[model samples]
Target: MERKIVKVGNSLGVIIPATYLEELGVTYKDTVDMEFNHDLQTLIIRNQKTKPNNKDHLEQVVKGIVDKYLKEKGL
Candidate 1:
């Protein structure tokens, strides 16, 4: 698909179709890696898996494991 660069505030940007983003399993607030390939004259976009910062989530997971271990040891 062809896209034209449009003005975005002070910088130019291209509008990526929503369908393309959906197909790639990406949504708003997701981090993507973009690189320019001079040899191929193409721009590569890839998903950068970002772990969500959830202190409560981590505590819950660790607590679950510790509880299981304690149960197994009967302590």
Candidate 2:
């Protein structure tokens, strides 16, 4: 698909079709990755990389584990 870049206020931007946004679950203010294809001489726009979560469900899990330990050890 081809699109034309237009100027908005002080920034140049492209209008993405709503269908693609819905399919990707993208929303306004979401971060995007901009890459240049050196071989094809083109630009690739994608979702920004996400950081890995090292503490998934940590609060509840820690509470449960501590409670169980206290009961088992009679602390």
The models' CA-based lDDT, in order, is 0.83, 0.76
Give the lowest summed-lDDT range of ten residues in model 2. Answer: 48-57
lDDT of 2: 0.76
Query: Which tens-of-lDDT digit does each residue in 7-70 have in candidate 2?
Result: 9999999899988776556689888777899999987666564432548646756887999999
Candidate 1 residue lDDT tens string, 1-75: 899999999999999899988855689999888889999999977556744358975896799899999999999
> TM-score per candidate, in order?
0.61, 0.52
Model 1 deviation from the true structure expressed as Cα RMSD, one decimal place = 14.4
Predictions: Cα RMSD each: 14.4, 15.7
Best by lDDT: 1
Quote the positional error of residue 53 for candidate 1 in Å: 24
Clashing pairs in 1: none
lDDT of 2 at 49: 49
